[model samples]
Target: MSVLETFQLAIKNILSSKMRTFLTMLGIIIGVCAVIVIVGLGNGMQGYIEDSFADMGTDSLTVMIMGRGSSRSVSEEDMYELVEENSEYLKQISPTVTMMGSVKIGSDTLTATSITGISEDYFSMKGYEVVQGRGLQYMDMTDRKKVCVVGQYLNMAYFGGNAVGQTLKINGNTFTIVGVMAQEGSELEEGGTDDCVFVPYSTAARLSYTGTISSYAITVQNTDQISEAKAVVEQKLYQVFSDDDAYTVTSMAELVEEMNSMVNMIIYILAGIAAISLVVGGIGIMNIMLVSVTERTREIGIRKALGAKESAIMRQFVIEAATTSSLGGVLGILLGYGLSALATSVIANVMPDTPITVSPSLLAVVVAFGVSTGIGVVFGYLPAKKAANLNPIDALRYD
Candidate 1:
């Protein structure tokens, strides 16, 4: 018989035993779906994290000091000296001092409010735009102005509306609200441009008895110069701290790279788990194919009696197994895509900055796994061979 005729017969047999064929295909379908969904989730999470970092500005670097054995703190003078030394390479350097305090507007008081002392560079470095009024200016820092910028939540919590040009007291010290920041998404709620109140660093220094800046934020001239700028800042910081290990200098790109590495490791681990499903599916195909060979023993003997070649019989059985796997693979791909889309939409709603991405390579791997499972006829070989070798006369005579 022609190859096409053999394929037709194989398909007909599978259609005749639709329930068994479907059960056999179930394994491949599940395996493919697992791989696609898991890998796509990994890709989406990575994309989401990276985008959040990008939204915070990639050209920024943070510097914090670690002191000697007895004390662990950064001096205000050390931060000022570092900034003065790196003025050429740095675009803007700001000293930041943060604390959680209560804000009071008239009789209303909101607790657990974020208050930070920052320089003029804080706005641009953190990608914050002034929605009302204006940001802190150089004069504000130098003059130690008792004015501050408030986040959107604080505005609503304290003043019940736009807090710009209003007066809010922090820890018993009243400050005029000169600016209000635009609403940044939830990603910023953790640690970004939003969800904080900003006062001049010098003013915060006067208010706090610590007399030290917590950290410094430095913006580079360009992203390409971030590495050089980090090195330069570190060198400058070392002159003051001298111990070299006392301070930590980190750039946004380096942080993102580390985060990506962590994400990739997670993806690999999940992918490994998903791969096991494919093996299980392949075994199911093998088991079903073996049963098919046993049930078709008499039919196989008749075919051989009609001069059907062993290779033809083997090819027909293999095609049947492959078709089952291939059909499952296609269904799995469709299901995987739908699952990815649904997950991405839910994640996007929660984290506007994080975009979920479906990886094409993951899809390819799923399809390949399905095809490999179909080719598991190698495992079904012993049964096919036994059936082909059966004597036609005996098969015909047997009940």
Candidate 2:
């Protein structure tokens, strides 16, 4: 028989037993869907992390000076000199000091707030906005004024309106609220602008009884010059700390690269796990094909007796198996993409800033479809060979 005739025969046979054909293809459907959904979620998470870093500004760098187990200790004065010397490379710099303390408003005491002491340039360097009142003035830091800026959460909780000019007690000391910050959602794992209470570095230094600041936020003149600026900052910091471990400087780009690598590793691992389903599906295909050959024994005998070559019998069965598996693969791809889109939409509602992206490349779909078809050829071969080699006389006499 011709190839077209064999294909028609295969289709007729499959259609004659619709329920059995569907059951045989079920495993392939599930396997393909599993792979697509797992890979899609991994890609979405990677995109969200990259976007978060981009919003924080790639031109910015953060510097931290260790206070213990170091050969040298960096002071606030060293940070000032570094900024002045590298004025061409540096745009804005601020030494930040932070500590946890209690805030008192009349009879209520909120003790879980983080108090951050910062210089006048801190707000601009960190991309913070003052929705009401104003940011810290130079005089506030220079004179160690007992004034502070409250976050949006505090303003909404205690004052219920503009918190500017309101008096609040901090760590039992009376301090006047000079500014109310705009709501900036959390970017890092620790906390964000919404959870902070800003004060002048001088007052923070006095309260903490230490001249050493926690960290510094520095912005570069241009993003392209980040490498040169980082080198200059590292040299300047080294002069004060002497040991490399005493201080650390990091840029947003480096952070993004590290996070991307970690996420990619996780993606491959999950993809490998999903691949196991494909193997299981292949095994299932082979078992069903074997059963199909036994059930169609009498048909095979009649075909062989009527001048049908063994090759024709084999081709008919192989084509049927491949067609069945391919159909399941196509359906799986459609269903997988639909589920991924639905999952992304639900995740968006829970976290507005996080974006879940599905990969637009059809590579995964094409590869999976090809694999499913290949699986059918390999697993269908034994059963097809058995049918082709059957003895027509014995097959006819048995039934």
Taken over the whole model, the C-alpha lDDT of each candidate is 0.75, 0.81
What are the runs in model 2 whose C-alpha is more than 4 Å off? 1-9, 51-59, 67-71, 80-91, 186-193, 220-232, 297-313, 341-363, 385-399
Clash pairs for candidate 2: none
Alpha carbon deviation, residue 30, candidate 1 (Å): 1.4
Tell me the lDDT of model 1 at 217: 84
lDDT per residue (tens digit) for residues 1-399 in model 2: 777877787788778888887778778888787778877887777778877777677778999877554446777777787878888898888888886678788998776678988999988876788989988999999899999998888887778867899998888888999898887774422244475689998898889887568688888898888889999989987776677887789998778878889987987787778777777777877888888888888888898899888998899888877877887788778888888888878887886666687652377788888988898888888888988899998777656
What value does the lDDT take at residue 92 in candidate 2?
83
| Per-residue lDDT of 313 in model 1 | 80
Model 1 CA lDDT for position 123: 84
Clashing residue pairs in candidate 1 (N, C-alpha, C atoms within 3 angstroms):
none
TM-score per prediction, in order, is 0.82, 0.81
Q: Distance (Å) between predicted and true CA of 394, model 1?
A: 5.7
